[model samples]
Target: MRRTMTRLGTDTIRRLPKVLLHDHLDGGVRPATLLDLAAQAGYQGLPETDPERLRAWFTAPTSGDVVRTQEGHLARFTPVLDLLQTAPALSRVATECVQDLAEDGVVYAEVKVAPEQHTREGLTREQVVDAVLEGVRVGTAKARLFGRRIDVRLLLTAMRQAADSLEIADLAVRYRHDGVVGFDIAGPEAGYPPTRHISACEYIKRENFNLTLHAGEGFGLSSIWEAIQWCGADRLGQAVRIGDDIAVADDGSAKLGQLAAYVRDKRIPLELCPTSSVSTGAVRDISEHPVDVLRRLRFRVTVNTDNRLLDGTSMTGEFTRLVEAFDYGLDTLRWFTVNAMKSAFIGHDERLELIDGVIKPGYAGLSTEHVGAAFFRMEDSW
Candidate 1:
């Protein structure tokens, strides 16, 4: 076995293969693409038209320790969603999303799309789904031409505050064999608990499809409990608040509450997005982030980029933050990648192929002294 490596750098992190489970379609528009789309649609709601300025504007602010509601933070996506009201715009966004992930070293990703939000301009939800899938097809082919391997799938999402979850659930199942792979309930997590969409969750379960709910964000442990115990969620999104159920002794050891114990014991994967968690007040800051603790406790913890544009984060960026904050190594990164692959909605054979064939070898090659003679740190200490 390859020993854990130290001194992993940003360049090394960028080369590592990644899997993303919880990302929003409307939240990750590239600034340049957003500008072009807005121009075409004649929508003038952008906060900044200059790509650099717009990027900084969209980047999550460093709101230290001040807890903010998710609704307010989510309202920022209005302009991007407005631009995606048409099929051509939706397809272009999806295409670029895959291209962007491929360039960022995401080999497999499941992006969430709330088609209901894009239907205001006369496009039916089915048309929206079809357009996005077409974009996925085109983007995958383009990536292949560039010698990049990536498989991007869609997760049909329903707003937690909406009453059309069952309809979204049906849409997900309708395209399960297509580019669609899972169903999710996103949007505000405050008053609209997962139980509010139990019918959709139950429908997904009865169909034997995958479900990952946005929990432990606006709400606390109760939200997580409902998503898992009540709704049978296969994974938890931004489950940072799970720390609420863990108590630490003066010696730095942890005592898990019943819910925390249940979550860990069941290996329910937590799609923890540190940067976004801090930006949304789900976490105070990177220093207080519990991902390292959760990983040490053997919880199924997978790092992710919640909203790439909004958080100014990618998978590698999230890993870099953890490495800088907690002194994580190549092996720790591998653990998170493998956990995400296992938690993916794809079939076991597909996940195994990527893990055994792609992810493992990629890390093994990087860990070797032969490959790292130039940049990677070879010492035991940072």
Candidate 2:
């Protein structure tokens, strides 16, 4: 049998109403910026001398959760973290990250970075938050200057293996109005569970602040279940493991386990990062990804670039991959984007404004009839 093609037209990917929910601050740093910052910080921990080689290095896998191809060795994310210790460096990287995402047509993004990881450079946690906030502020301004406005929010992540989940949660609450939208517990989802930081999560909840957990990426349904039941996360980062609870019958009927059913019925958002999942060995291939299955089951699934650098992907590249892998036509693309917008931490009023003012109008002007009459209802809702 012949193989099917998965490449989509560049125009279609660019025009989609894209919203990114799972990007990481440490993992999404630009390769060229990494070189410049490494030199400025006088850090000599890089694997390659030139930017291109270093770019290749970051994407290549090693003993970490991320995997690599044979010829191109993957670069460990440690060196990148080592270089991004100061506020200025963190700010610059965060600024450029937003610019890159905006160029790829992402209208909204929630960039997460572990503050504890940046403390080795002699800065306080508050200083690190300030630096990243400065970067997002500048980058958002830059996007507008280019005639495109992208809303960028910071989601602070506390490293599970490290101390200070409560400290970081406090930081998120402090900066909530100043561009920080929510709190997350990232790093090592296997041995470290969300319940470890139950107090911190509960504090965030009591304050009525937003929360999203990095569960089900490296683990399974139990991890996801705890995140929702115990931690009460508003969104799940890379909850692909929910697929384990979904059973497909020979007759093509799917049976969702209790956890999966609850998540779907409650409409809890799953921040699905296809390319990053593959890089980290969460899924063997894109076609086998449970995003489509969850979508068909009415699960609130959204697409994201978990780590743009490591995955060698953009929001456009991610959507293109899905289109090719599953023949996901324009309608599916719209659903993905719209779902992301709805699931964004932004308020319902602002989401309505974006849907009415930007997304609906933009897609309608595309005039692609293949998207069908569903577009009509989406537009009318706006």
Candidate 3:
């Protein structure tokens, strides 16, 4: 088993099978799409006049620092929200988002976006839901036509600082068959707790809808605890701050706090967005990411691009960052990719089909290409 695990082919990792459990539809808009949609909608608040400039603005460094700095912090989440205020605009962005993810080598992606944020143009919650679904349907069909297969699932989020979470939950359940997979709460995570939307959480639970809450990112373990124990979240988004509850002993051993032990033992899925986490200051750096510790400890760690445009990343980039930071070889990459596929918010049979039909075969084909020494080196202490 060890030899088989250690000898993962470079080609397999290069093909880099991936499943994204936590990307935001509004947050993942292609700059070109946003530009065209803004023009069609007669809105003129775009940061740049042209798509190339907008793309550069999205990916370029802010405040003069190239690597890590505070110059680009505000540009991360606010730009997407700024441009995605109208329903038609949101729909166009969401549709192109799938195309973008597919081009970036994501086989399956679940994009989360709050419907409430796009209603500035008098769009009802139902209208918002339908429009986003239409976009995903079109995008997925286009992907299949181009021989790049991917299943896009929409997860409706209720802004944490806002009311009417139950309304959003109802919208999610109503569109279950129309590409909507689950319900979530997203927004400023510091002050507005998940308990603020208890009714929505309750509705999701009663309706058997999937739930993933954004917790333990900027906040601490208390936020994570409430999302799981108080709200019954099936998965967690950016649950990086749970590292605070973990302790490393003097003799190279580790001890998990009560919350950490429960979360690890129960195998709760953590949708970790490495670049996004760093941009948001959720962790000190990529190398210090708790994902390595969590993965080695047998936790259900899933890789995601929380916001592609904001973080200037795709699934491939996130995987490459992990590989570089943790010395993760093909085995670890495959493990993480498969873990993401299993944790997707889809039915058992559908996920099985994707894994067997596309993911496994893709990796096997890549495995025959490269027989390198190793791509990354794992820490002995780890």
Candidate 4:
């Protein structure tokens, strides 16, 4: 067992073997890649052509406020999506996505892509899936040459407002053996509830496939309730609004509402992206983010970069924010990493291999002080 009193620094956090469960492929296109694709495809919708300015443009708020409506934030993906219409463009984006995650020290990632959005170019849904999978394969091979071990998988997402969820669900199942791992429903969670895709969810469940829903971000607890109870979501994406169901008394004691209690008790994973949550108005800012409360209460909390380009965030940045806000050290960081590994949509043996083999050892090797009994006790339990 390793006990450390030193806080997790940027370099250490970057080197940690992190697992991501709720990242979006369309929302994470590199600014340079977007510019190149736009040029190649003859699409000219980008606000800025210069790489630095374009990066700033994507990350900057729409109305000079850091917080925006979920719909407003989502609209920023239009340029990226426009360029990703062709198979080659899709492959390039997917390859670059994996390379970026690998460079950021992601050990395993399940990236979500909506096939329906890429069909305007006349590519069939199967062709779209195959292109992305090819990119994943190419990216993985390239990463291995550089000694970066990143295992990437796909999650096929259906737009909640659309009626093509069952189609998307079938596609996800069809490609389960060829890099696709799970199913998800994304987009405007308010009016288009998860129940709108209940048939898709049921099909996934009946097929024993994994499902994660974008709940409690754009909407409130009802959305989360439907996603979990009605739709049988395996994970909740940015479930920050769950804090609404919790109360803390003046004495500093806490009480959980029924939904929150059930969520915590079941060890349901909350894929909380702190910066993205702020951008989407899920919380006012990182300081008020519910991840700290959920983590303290022992809910299965995992930090993620919901969108690297849109949020201008990475796994390193996410952990750095948490460390600054909550004073979290290596132990806390290790706990979060381990929690994500345990909750991933991978096989049990593979999950255990990453935890015991990669994550724990990586954290144990970091430079730190010989913190005594308290740290050792935590290590024993872990």
Candidate 5:
């Protein structure tokens, strides 16, 4: 029997309840808000003053070095990070981040931020955390007003090249009862291995806190090895290169090497960012991403929008592309959502509540004109 094509539309995918585990707060500031904040702070570093042009300027490169590909992706966040130095700016950014995610049908999300990067404007690290958390509070409250309910938390990041991992880890533990849920190390992963931040990882483990490491984006399998085996990471951020450890013979039989086998055997969650992977040159294109192979192999994989502004993508966009590329339907999308919820840093009961209560039933709504959302109203679903 021939296989029936399982196609999903962007409209339907947009309405499905999403659980996002990887998102950078600073990389997703609203354009209009950025302009308003610039005026309030008297900052003049914007490449384009107009909101539309400024939004384009972030991911567009008209000049020699401003390209938007892997080479120019990191440059897009320079001005954003600089603009987010003050407490108010951080809070507003966090608030809008939640609002946007909620609007995109994301019911649960953990937005990551590096507090050390935002301290240049005389705000203490604690103040930075406080401001972001405050914004999360306001954002959640505002989402309800719009008939959208979103739960957002923060994951404090430490620069892998810096000596502040221990400090950041301790800070995350300090706010465990608050909105902060986990600690992470992110930077250039080639020269700065995860082993370098052993103290922080150990500290988080000892404190019984959550830990995820950024690895295998611009590097190779060794970086992933160190992240999983050395640092004891609970999840692998941008672990696109873990696919390299799998080898295929001429007859099309695939084999997993020791490291890859270990990763798959352990069911370590991989926070795969397809669009950002292409933007960062981790993979040439979304169709070429390892997510398909990894999924077929039953690897613990989840989808994420790494930097919404830089990639000009969202959780919905990511799912749309995956559906288009792989011809996936509701089952495939649900798998990714459940993987994210299970891998989330929140407590087991909370995760189960969302997985069983919101995500599954929301997706079960009859497919109507609006991609499975017509039968279930936002207010009614909750």
Candidate 6:
């Protein structure tokens, strides 16, 4: 059965119901917000006082180096982290994150934040989580006033280099009923393996909490393997390196290695952020991103903006890039959205409700020509 195709434009892409699974809270703080917070807190560490210049600084590619290392990419977060020491700053950043995602048509998002990094100015870890949750509440309410219904949940992140993984895991479980939905370990993933936090991952599992590890981005297959086998990651944050296990022949057919086949067969979700993958030197460019190959292989692939401000990208921007590179239409876009909703840490009933009631209906409302045709194929695929 064939259906009439409507061209996917920027406006349509922006209006589609998107789900984001791997955005970073500190990395997404607006330049204007950072400047304002810096001034308020009397923090004079900002390189540029002007918001425009600061925005340029934050978004500019690191150096002219041929390859940007993960540590080099992470260095950009220092200034933003410096500004998020207080409750007000943390709250404002979180609220604005939701607002920005809503404007970009993100129906649901799991934003990751490292509370351990935010405790420098005397705030406890619990207080940091509380502040961010308060901001999410305010942002959700504000988005509703504009008729943008966005469900923003927190994934408390523990820096893999730090010794507070167990503490952060406990904090995530403590606030699971609040606004926090899952637990994660993020940071330089090379030397600091997910195994370092085995106790934390075990704790989260024992408590029946969700966990996602920043694996296979700067590292390789071993990182991905440990995250799944040893640490028991529910999802992989930037599992771009899994592509190493996938081979494409001269004729364009693809083959998955044992590990890749396991991931695909088990429906493990890969939070693939194309642009960020390039920025971190995980992939050469967007065209070479593993997301396209993984999606075509029927692996549970989800598109995300790892850092909106740092990468100068949004859900709309990410989808637009994919559409340009791969000529993806509404159907392909809906597949990614449904993949994310299906992989969400929320209750299965709520996940189905959003996918059937909110997401599919929202997309169906976009084009009169296709009506239900666009999603009908997706219903069976998922």
Which regions in candidate 6 have their CA more than 4 angstroms from the true location? Answer: 1-7, 369-375
Q: Is 4 or 5 the stronger prediction by lDDT?
A: 4
Q: Output the TM-score of candidate 1.
A: 0.94
Question: Once all C-alphas are superposed, what RMSD does model 6 give against the true structure?
Answer: 1.6
lDDT for 332 in candidate 3 is 69
- How displaced is residue 111 in candidate 6, in Å? 0.8
**What clash pairs does model 2 have?**
6-324, 57-75, 60-74, 61-68, 61-74
Give the number of the best model, judged by lDDT.
6
**Tens digits of per-residue lDDT for model 1, 65-184:** 255557767877888887888888888889999999999999999999998999998999899999999988998999989999999999999998889999999999999999899999
* Cα-based lDDT at residue 292, candidate 6: 84
> Distance (Å) between predicted and true CA of 86, model 4?
0.6
lDDT of 2: 0.82
Q: Rank the candidates by lDDT, best first.
A: 6, 4, 1, 5, 2, 3
Scanning candidate 4 in windows of ten residues, the lowest lDDT window is 373-382
Residue 113 of candidate 2: its Cα lDDT? 78
Cα lDDT tens digits, model 4, 188-268, are: 887898998899999999999999999999999999999999999989998889999999778867899999999999989
Better model by TM-score: candidate 1 vs candidate 5: 1
Candidate 4, residue 356: CA error in Å? Answer: 0.9
Candidate 6, run of 10 with poorest lDDT: 371-380
Q: After superposition, how far is residue 88 of candidate 5 from its true place, in Å?
A: 0.9
- TM-score, every prediction: 0.94, 0.92, 0.88, 0.96, 0.92, 0.96
Q: Over the stretch 194-280, how does candidate 6's per-residue lDDT look in tens digits?
A: 999999999999999899999999899999999999999999999999999999988879988999999998888999999999888
Rate residue 262 of model 5 by lDDT.
93
The alpha-carbon deviation from the true structure for residue 317 of candidate 1, after best TM-score superposition, in angstroms, is 0.6
TM-score of 2: 0.92
